[model samples]
Target chain A: MINSEHTAIMLIAVPLLGAFTTAVFGRVSSSLRNIWVLAILASTELLAVLLGVNVLEKGINVYALGASFPTLTSPEGFPVRIILEVDAMNALISLIACTITLIVVVYCLGFMRESRVLDKAYTLILLLLTGMLGLTLTGDLFNLFVFFEVVSISSAALIAFYVHRGQSLEAAFKYMVISATGALILLFAVAIIYSQYNLLSMAALAASIKYTFLDEVALVLLISAFLLKAGSVPAHMWKPDAYGEAPAPVAVMLLTSALVSLYVLFRITYTVFNPVTPTIGWTLALLGVLSIFLGVSMALIQTKLNRLIAYSAIAEIGFILLGVGSSLTQSPHTSKVGFNALSGGLFHILNDVLDLGLLFLAAGAIYYLTRENNMNRLGGLGKTHPVLGVFFLIGLLAVSGLPPFNGFASKLMIYESVYFFNPLFAIIGILGSILMAAVYVKAFYSVFLGVFPPQELGQIPKSMLAAMGVLALLILVIGLYPATVIKYLITPAADALINPGDYIGGVL
Target chain B: MALKWRYQRMLANIAYITVVVLIGLGLYAIVFKQNLIKIVMGVHIMGSGVNLFLISLGYREGGVAPIYTLAPKLEMVLPTPQALTLTSIVINLAVVALMLSFVMFIYCRYNSIDSQDRRLRG
Candidate 1:
């Protein structure tokens, strides 16, 4: 067995090396490539789970690169080397990323079986996984920026996988431009922080940050850049285009990528800049409100299936932001309401990934059958694929925060806690959930319920069904056992956010 | 002695101003340019501006290069920013190549590189 100290780095390196190895195998035989890819993903998933368990059990796990021992974070009380820190929050997000990537790869096995670029697609997917895992685990600011670029570049390449479609190319261009700009802005912020302190490790920076004018400038830049990358409204135009045009499994990965950006946003705000001013908190809260309103309103009007789902994904991001932002407003003060809001936000991230992943997979199944994206052109799919229709319904209910599903459990937390923050915010959130229900119901009706002339449709591969089933099942389990998940996973994650001392102490 | 300090400060201000101008021009190009190639150029310019700013942060007056082999009994500039700038430059190169390739595909399909082309819009 690999030593537990090495799991964090292995979670990143295995896939980075596996990506090219898979490519080489791809050149020999496709089946061999598939097997190799699966092995890599499974091992990486195992590593993530191991890391998560270790962190949960023993507190923050720090692995320093180039150190004589992996656990040596700071040599002689100075942290100069690149470090990988797995606190509860990082572990939670990494587990989510890994599990979702595994499911998507399974789905891709069936979804892309007939595509010519299957080999290249798998390579890019592995690379994308490496990037996501690295983004979540790194403890250094520069390392974070590097992984940020990695995620952006790989996902942008995957977004254009369907090169024959001009729109895919167009969407990829737009995504690349936005991501490159966001990343450069992030680099600028890192440079600003480095210039001030000459320290690159997040723990050291957080410990030493004086909140000067330059620090404030760096803070603003970091927030804006990440918010832009996270696809919040007013900076969300690239999302619909990219998600609507990319292959379905890739779209799910893209959503996770955006969620990682959201994770980083919270990490920087709460940890690096602890006790952030109320003004920053208000800025985040207001943006969250705007994203909720604008995202759903825009989603309601979208005619394309994936684009509509993409807009709703933006709204889901808003809910998480609202919870985190409201909690931030009460910084340096651990109130029950703020803690509950933060827990809700963290819990919502898991629910969002499962719920949105299910919805996108179902949409892909329909598109696979019908070769149509416009909802108007799709009908009677439910009659043909009843299981898929039920899965879609599960996704629809969950995404709209209907009861007996995971979305409701988390959204309720957001609503209840944020209501205490501001009643008006909760009111708007409730209204947005209502409108979201309407949007998805309309989508369900148009895509699955309506009658159309029967036509021959190919069967959705068992792998695809299995993937969707896994997500639906997870959603149900979480919905049924919300308290259990919150007790074990989310509360610690939220605690990690509020208390940066543990993170700093683990390193310094 | 006061004049020397003033001159050094002015030089620093001028360097910072150049960085700002480069970034501004890049943003303008990205936001305003119709041609996809020009927008990509804009991204490159913006990235260059950031890289320049990062490198400037490491500059030290009358300092030797930050190389272990080149022994000098003098101050060495901060090496981290230079390493970071190099990484940023490589990332920008990959991004530009990807963008330009996408532009090539867009042009091939649409016969135009205009980002405002209707088919590319929502």
Candidate 2:
């Protein structure tokens, strides 16, 4: 057995190595490849859970890449090698990425079984998982940018998996252009920082950052690039196209990747550029409100099933940005309300993943059964597949923050905290939730409860149903016991973001 | 002495200004051009500009290659930015190849490489 200390690097290496090995196995037999892929995913998820537990117990774990010992962050009194740091915050995000990837791979086994490009799809999926894991785990700024490109390249390839459809190819092209441009801008910013300080480690840079003129420019470039990648309003034109056209399982991973981009944004703002001015916070808050309004309003008019859900996902990102943005506005001396807002934001990430993952899976199932995604043609599905109806209804309610669901718990935290910060912010958030609920209700009525006769639909594979069931169960559990999750998980992650001193000290 | 100093400063300024122009022209092509292939070339151009900026950050007036085994004892240019530029170049290569392939498929399906064609709209 590998020592527990090496778990951090293993989390990334396992899937990276597994991806190529699976391809070689694919040439031998499909069943062999399936088993190999499943085993690798299962092990990766297990490793993530273990790493999360370790971080919870040990506070923060830092591993220097070329040092004699893994924990030796600074050999010459300064960090000279690449590092992998797992604070409570990173561990939480990595756990979410691992769980979602594992579940989606299981769903893929059923969804893509009939396709000719199954091996290539699986390879790209594992590569994407590696990128996400590396993105969350790395402590070096340059390493983070490399993994960001990795996620973008693999996801763009996967989005165009259906080569027969021109729309998928177009969507993939647009996503590639946006991601390439955004990443190049990010590289330019990184270059500026390196030229200023000759340092690439994030924690070290945070300790020494003086917020000089060039640093401020770098910050602007960094935030804009990450915001574009995170699919915030004004730069979100590529999101719906990518998410709507990609295969269903791949769409779920893409949404998670966007959330990871948001995580990077928060990390940079809170840690690297600590004590940022309130103007930046207000800018984020303004963008959040715009994203909520625009995402839901556009979702209401969407005639395609996956496209509607993609818009709703954007709205969900709004809630998180609002919560964290409000928290940031009170930085350098955060109040109790600010703390609650940050926790609420982190908790909403968990709720959003479960809610949106289930919804996208259901959309995939619909496409699988009827071979159609147009709302005008998909009717009376509930009458034929009551099980799928229940699953989607759960997703819709949770996404809209309806009661007895996890979304309500987290949104309540955000609303109450932001209300204390400023009543107007809370009012806009509540109004957005109301509009989102109406939008999903209309989608539900159209797809599941229409005035059309029942059509002959194929049976949804057991693996697909099983995937949806797991997410639905998690939502209900977290919803019913919000306090338990908030205490053990959300608080630590929020605290990690609130206090950058501990993170800097861990590395330096 | 002043003339030499001014000449060096002028060169540095030219390098920075060239970087800005390259990035600006690339952005113009991406935003205003209609042809898919041109947009892809624009992305590559933007990448080249960033890479050039990175390389310029590491330049020394009289420096040796950053190899430890070399005999020269003169100042070596900052090796880190050069390394970063190489990595960026490789990533850009992958992105350009993937994007051009996507453009090929788009053309094959739509019989047009024009991004303005309505069928590409989602």
lDDT by residue (tens digit), candidate 2, A1-508:
6677889999999999998898899999999999999999999989998888999999888887888554454423444478899999999999999999989988988898899898899999999999999989898989988999999999999999898999999999999999999999999999999989988999989999999999999999999999889898879899899999998999999999999989999999999999899988888987888899889999999999999999988888889999999899998788999999999999999999899999999999999998899998888888889999999999999999988999999999999999987798899899999998998888889889976645666889999999999999999999999999999889999999989998998887
Residue A341's lDDT in candidate 1: 94
Deviating ranges (above 4 Å) for candidate 1 = A69-79, B1-8
Candidate 2 ranges with C-alpha deviation above 4 Å: A69-79, A452-454, B1-8, B120-122
Clashes of each: 0, 0
Interface RMSD of 1: 0.9
Residues A163-223, candidate 1: write the lDDT tens digits: 9999999899999999999998999899889988989889988999999999999999999
True contacts kept of each: 0.76, 0.84
